[model samples]
Target: MSKQFAFTAEQLKSFRENGYAGPFDAYDQNEMKETYKKLRAEIFDRSHAIYDLEHSSLLAGYDRHLDIDFFSRHIMRRQILDKVEGILGPNLLCWRSEMFPKYPGDEGTDWHQADTFGHASGAPQVVWPMNTDFGGAITVWTAVTDADKENGCLRFIPGTHEEMHYDETKEMKYSPEQVNKLEKNGMKSGFFGYDYRNLQKDPSWVPDDANAVSMEMKAGQFVIFWSTLMHASWPNTSSNRTRLGFTARYVPTSVRIYPDTDVINEYGSKLSLDKYGVVLVSGQDEYKHNRRLLKNARGLEFATALDELETA
Candidate 1:
């Protein structure tokens, strides 16, 4: 496998310290634009989508990589997998992917961290081994369109991944009516339909935005970060431009995904995991804790470095 996009020693060191790394180049501007155009066309065609939900539902964007060939290939890209392997080891599995679109006048995402990813749903979505107390997926977020402060760029607080500020077990009321209406520290933000502040360990404490750094990226650039990092985004304050981001969440093969849950209930929608399966993007899965898929819903096989080597 080519090590062209693998994280350097310095980059890995910085990632270990800061809990995040890179707005690395994945696709050129023209390629990204063309991909975006094709994605727009395919997004509405939910024939192969795993979830049966209305297009307007917030949960509609979940796990498209399972059905979309482009996304299936995207999650297996060397640029992304190599960096993820550097952190999570060679045995990697992509369990989830979500589409984040910030239309004009849309409120920014609330500042929050997800360890078990159960803030919205009452049950834990992912659980690490009993030996490890720390658990959170590595998220690779790619900018599908140009993102800036005006168009809702991502913001992160470095070195915040180790500690848990919010309790995932805490129940957060989903209130879609409150979207774009709530303001925090003079900034308009909300966690999709739910208020993330409800899950805070300390109800009186607030995030220190003074230390937060904005990640403004060009089209096709991707950033890797821990899912436990305290992160959010700016409101899309632009008159017309909309910010689009795609995030793929990865964890080592040993982690148990969706333990004891066949149905996912979040964002006021319910989804059955009957067709859900994690993609083994790199290496081998000896633990086999979760269902693994070799091909996407479109019948296109997911290519990995090992697969390429065997074929070559």
Candidate 2:
């Protein structure tokens, strides 16, 4: 089953150890730009999602219903699904999807895990838009525009995916609460500057080497990563040009949705997955995609394998 494009044992090992993968370029830029321009105006409404200024959570937020728009409605469209099936396996379900845009000079987002809102199911947070083999949600981060360190690209930690999340006493949902919580826990927000202002830095953190290497992708490149990969974005210090990226999550059917608790805030959010007119992967799907993906997928760390790469 291992194909040339499938993930290598070393790549899998790295993903297992590092918690994240890729700076790999997944698609052509010109076409992606064209597709992005169309989808942005059509699906996302070109409107900024209002946030809970204090907590930063989306107030009302964008809908994850794929049926609302053509672009979103087909999250498992062949091109993407084929690749996903290759990685995670046949049985799959969507976790959620959202548009993330960092306006010029904007402080992107904070470093955090995805499941602060729920409990760990197979492995929570590490599933996939591709396949959640690692138990975390798989997120396909498609960049609509250039994502560089200057305009706030993503940062990830290696080898931190296995850490279970509990006692998130600091995962506050409002600004005041977050501030108070940070103060009480003695956490600092001083690592980088957002719009020229230094913000708070997290106390306990992720894989130490995650940020030392990062993706500087041009518009159109999509980076697929695990939700458990401790990831963050840099502040957009550029006076112009915005950074636009969106993420979609895919989960395996085997993992159950964690029951809702007030601790998560979403009152009655059930997996409610049956709602998708057609389940992308009806628990019955073989998840053959994981093996398929394993066959072709290459790990970023494997770049060191080629003697030419080292000498160049």
Q: Clashing residue pairs in candidate 1, if any?
A: none
Off by over 4 Å in 2: 1-5, 8-10, 24-26, 44-70, 77-83, 119-134, 165-171, 176-211, 258-312
lDDT of 1 at 231: 95
The per-prediction CA RMSD against the true structure, in angstroms, equals: 1.7, 11.7
Write down the TM-score for model 2: 0.62
Task: Write model 2 residue lDDT over 232-289, tens digit each, in one string.
Answer: 6766778997887767677666544332221223312223322222134323434433
Best by TM-score: 1
Q: In terms of lDDT, which candidate is strongest?
A: 1
| Alpha carbon lDDT at 5, candidate 1 | 75
All candidates: TM-score: 0.96, 0.62
After TM-score superposition, what is the CA distance of residue 69 in candidate 1 from its true location, in Å?
Answer: 1.3
Cα displacement (angstroms), candidate 2, residue 310, comes to 49
